[model samples]
Target chain A: MNTTQTPCRELQVLSCRPGTEPTLVDLVLSPPGWTCRAGQFVMIRPLDWGSELVWPRPFSVCDVSDAGLRIFFQVVGRGTRKLAGLQPGQKVAVWGPLGRWFRIDENRPNLILAGGVGIAPFVMLARREKTDNLSMLFGHRLDLCHYPYAEIADRIESEAMRQTTAADIAAFETVLSGRIKTLSGIGQVLACGPEPMLKVVRRYCLMHGTEGQISLENRMACGVGACLGCVGRTVTGEYVQSCVHGPVFDVRDIDLGE
Target chain B: MDQTVQLGPLTLKNPVITASGTFGYGLEFMRYGDLTALGAICLKGISLAPREGNPTPRIAETPCGMLNAIGLQNVGVKKFLAEKLPYIPPGTTLIANLYAQTPEDFGELAAIFAAQERVAALEVNISCPNVREGGVQFGQDPAMAARVTSAVKKRAGSKPVMVKLSPNVTDVTVIARAAVDAGADMLSLINTLSGMSVDIRTRRSRLANIVGGLSGPAVKPVALRMVHQVTRAVQVPVIGMGGITSAEDVLEFILVGAHAVQVGTFNFMRPDNAFRLVEEVRTLAESLGISSWDEYRGTLRA
Candidate 1:
């Protein structure tokens, strides 16, 4: 439990890209010593804002490097709309390398599933894990939400885009079931997306007797455990904070049912 | 410059205390800044038994503030004493925020802390809006608020008792007067205002608990107004908090007669907020040519 309050630093934007969507922005921030696990997130706020935008927004760690770390986000609200407008060399206050990350087992095969901006966390996971042992399935309602990852595409088995439809879901299930059956050893499923998508993934893991972990996206004020805002129910009917206990949790442990 | 301020019998090194529930036992923040720099560390709300708290989506962000229904999820008082108390930096003032389903529960918790030397005071939380039980119920009524205050004071022994008052009432001063009359040594106001948010896309409530306490800069004016009114109504020292984030906000509360101010939701935005606030207060005080806070305390003109 390395739950230290992440120091606030002014991260200089190295580059900015008009990601897969017009509203989505890809930012490269160079803040020295900014390190995070595959499923971890950072709390970011614009320095130029007034009290109107007081709370910071949480974003999953998209990618990392010695030069800096990358974050991908959509301009869904006022806070992010302001973030998307930031240019290269601009600085934003960032506090992170926070929250629990995915538990990677190198020996086992990995099946990664992501939806829309949920693809953010897996970018780091893909970079860390051995590509040969990894398989990815990405779903999107529109092509604009698809992220272009040239680096890890050659090493890993990946499906860049599967339309989010009833027909595509069945096809995805068949493809996923076949992949699971063909793996030489025990494999795990890791997913992040909307609740409906996560529910489908949960059912697949339950039916196949495979272990899975899902990263949840709850609206949060403090990325730390102090606020008790991002709580989710465990299978045992007890509530655990999604920020501290997890942004990532074992599928078996999370009780998604209402 | 004199930074120390007296709150009843207790003398705080500074006037910046970390509001309860946001600081989380104070040890978790050691890496961000110096914990001892704060006037006091008001530990998260504690009860006689461990609480699991509300269901998922317990928090939601509003226009300028956020709604949280944490339900005072904390380990029991005994566990807090055993696991958390020893970790608090030596010589740091620890104000235990006590909550319960009834006045008797508050009495039991107060008695437990009354025996601990390190426990400086008890911020009896009869104003929490998240819990469905005795929190806001006791805070809303002046008589019940007095009863809870007296119950904790009776068992608190030598330790001072500060009654935390809620702003979700018709006249907060009436409740403040009641707590003061019931032997409350000091008062802290105003707890989060009751609020809720909804998701238009799903046509469902954003928080699983449906409603929660709203805290942040959004509630500052309301909190300041309540603190101002209560200070004029009661003789006990006042610790004001509602959306205090800056040095100016702290000064505004002091100008309205708050002996000290609590930093709450701002801690989430900046972990070292208390330290920064302490320095800001010092610099501001020095610039104003004031030797002590007493010169400016309650200096707000009509």
Candidate 2:
């Protein structure tokens, strides 16, 4: 569903789940307004409430279905507090199926990297009925809150997984041994989560000659280019709005970390 | 509907005006909507000299809001006169939002603006810290607010002067009274609140600057209450703004004592939001049998 089809005024809350008390919320919107690629987001505003949050808050679309849209967010201030407490049957005002999406090639095996709630959008893609040959390597502080993904068959690291250099990879390979398949035939890699994990994914992809795209998070005002607020400097030195230019970019085009 | 509003000596064709810092020179949003329909345009905050502003990561997103410390980046008054002032639309209120490090800087800029009849009013923005005056002087104290107001009014000569107050103060009403006593003709209340966002894993500040001013819906209630308080304290009209995105929001401002309201952060979300807001207010007023939007001003109960 392209976002243009959904009018800004109409949105329905389909389901609600609690995350990180009084702070984080996982909500799915009803009657899916639009189709969004893995890295895109939508703007949601609480309707009819005269409280000060008149501008919409941009949230990554954790999952989407024919029934509605789903979002995972942490309640930080007034806006999210209002959003988090909303009842399931209630309505919320929403705008856009916005921003560019991460590209995927069906011909290659997919490698998904997620950290914390950054796993939301990728989980939405992995839940698809037709998706195949997908593997997710997720890093989280603990195992309790790891996202529920039924399709992600292999986990590269879990409670026992630690940051490994080349020597550790050799010793770790002993566990998989002959079962470990080379990343060959993997045309593109998709990763989102924390900047550090993404930094590591970019390096690993390059060392293995695997192509990759990563989703970035930033402080955004207008989920569009109008505000010039949520901007990131590309490798080219030009400032581009993360909301418009992308929450997703080719790993090669970004300067993640020195 | 005929779009125009009267702000003291100036008559604006529409009640929709761009808030400072969001629209740059009023030229940026012109590409998206008809600038002439606006009641007025307040250019980005201008200081005596050009400022490069704060370092990188000037902005960061929160749950339902964003923080910014652009630090009033803009060319000086001379460049504004040379490049920006010429394009002011006839009948549109062209307000120059002046920020300075000293009362003298404001006086000088006001005198420069006074020379140009096209400039409608001098909006003294005392929110920026007065670097030379020892400490955070202008905004925190009522005396400094009045001092800046008096300085600008004196240089403004015959032109009406409006003072835009900072929200960082303890009591906005005290500051409002001081500006009125100092000869200000109008007031714009409640700039962004100071805020910060930190990356959980990195445990570093989300913004390049350690802290920034919070804007958008998060600060609306705080802004509205300040507008109400300031309007009650001062005899001059108040222009209330912060998180105003709809016509109902405008009505809320008017009911709370705002003579007019400015749309700030919403301009970034939807370029056409202001134009739509103006039309919506007019239609709602007519539907309710009110001849003018002003009829509902300051109707808030207690």
Candidate 3:
């Protein structure tokens, strides 16, 4: 894959809004040549901060437009906290359009399972495809936290769980099984969110005999596959760097063991 | 300015090389910057057989540095020679960083790399802290270090062997002397300091392996001291590294008698750092009125 290293540039922030939660920052960066596909991500670092945080943080490409690329993130750690404080004209070192993107088969019906910020990538996937054969299942704590997905999704189903528990997952799985039966053709399941949600998605795909792809979220030091920090286990018992081999992997290939 | 440096029979275009374990096979960084601008690329550590490495949470961030227990995860020698070697851009000097559990394993790996036409040199890794055995264990003991060095040198054929020294030792010079005595053509110091981190909330170790090798700017002072000590003790050319971030850092190592310098953690910070350092070193050399690196190599006034 041909990846470009975009230097630190002042991205004119279109807007920073509180999406569904107080911690969530929906930021839009209008940097030129910032084209990205769904599931691809960028490494972002604060400019002028010396040695305090040496590594760049990786965030999935939420949405892209002629205006700019949108990154929806929850301020969880020091890096994200610093990013949340950035003003409209401030610059950040952004390097990417990296990693393999979500492979969508136009012929197969698409089922997207997203939780929290994981909803970021699916928005782009839905907007790009503009297909009627898409079904989205979003799990969130509060109704406000749900991404405004009415415009992009063809058939949207959501479950509000304060915290996704075993019971909630079982219910979600039952709903997914029913959804799979109603679809006419062989469908593909794509998932991104918390690891637990992905585990559920993986199991659902296995039981229903549906092909699945998952975007893994691992703590990464270098988003460009140098550090080997973000590694996921493969079914073949080998470890592959999530930054390069994938942020996206076949659900069958990944060994997500407890 | 004259930028080329000689390590045994290998001649590098400049004194800026990418450190092992930091630069993945040299192809990943090509899109980010001009990789050919580098003097050489020291690939990730390669063992006799494929290693799965450590479990999850193999990395932890600390003040001005990071700790990693990657455990020398690589695609083994055979796959590396087949899949990785062909992809390297022509004219780029490639150094194979080899690791093994025993002296015989080291000899076998050396022979494998020695047969390869593309490899410019073999960097015998005697100092990887992440692995449970044969990594820092052989590196810390002078006798064992000498054995590993001799084993590689015997089968290395005409290929030059550079022993990468570990900083986790009582006296780094002892190990340096041992490798040099065993026919090591050049030396690279230091690998990474043994360190660990813990999570306060969970009350658990940060890395799965409990302890990992620490790299980045935090270890620069220690690395510089070791590089200075070892270079003065050994007759062979030295390749200095440890938390080198800028051109000034590269020059400091050169001033301490390093023929060349390797940039490690900084690659994570900026993928084009090695390319940038080539220009920075030239600019600095011109400003200082030093036409050649030889004039200032080890000319440190202490």
Strongest candidate by lDDT: 1
- State what share of the real interface contacts each candidate retains: 0.55, 0.25, 0.48
Tens digits of per-residue lDDT, candidate 3, B52-94, equal 8899888988999999998888888989888988888888889
Candidate 1 residue-wise lDDT, B1-302, digit = tens: 98999987899999999999998998867767788778999999999999998776777777778888888888888899899889888988899999999999899999999999998999999999988889999999989999999999999999999999999999999999999999999999989999989988999888888988899999999999999999999888999999998888999999999999998988877666788889999998888888788888999998
**Model 1: residue B134 alpha-carbon error in angstroms:** 0.9
TM-score of model 2 relative to the true fold?
A: 0.64
lDDT of all predictions: 0.84, 0.71, 0.83
Per-residue lDDT tens digits for candidate 2, residues B1-302, read 44355678867675667788777677655545567777778878887788655656777655445678766667788888888777755655688888888888889989988888888887888764322241236877888888888999999977889888878888888888888999999998777787788878999997667888777777789999999888888778889988776777777888898888888877765556676777898887677666665666788776
* Candidate 1 residue pairs that clash: A242-A246
Could you tell me the TM-score of chain A in candidate 3?
0.87
Candidate order, DockQ descending: 1, 3, 2
For residue A104, model 1's alpha carbon misses the true position, in angstroms, by: 2.1
Question: Which regions in candidate 1 have their CA more than 4 angstroms from the true location?
Answer: A1-6, A177-185
DockQ for every model, please: 0.56, 0.16, 0.54
lDDT tens digits by residue: candidate 2, A21-138:
4355778778654566777888787555544444567888877778678787766676678788777778776666678886766666666666666777875676652546566655
Question: Top DockQ: which candidate number?
Answer: 1
Q: On DockQ, who's better, 1 or 3?
A: 1
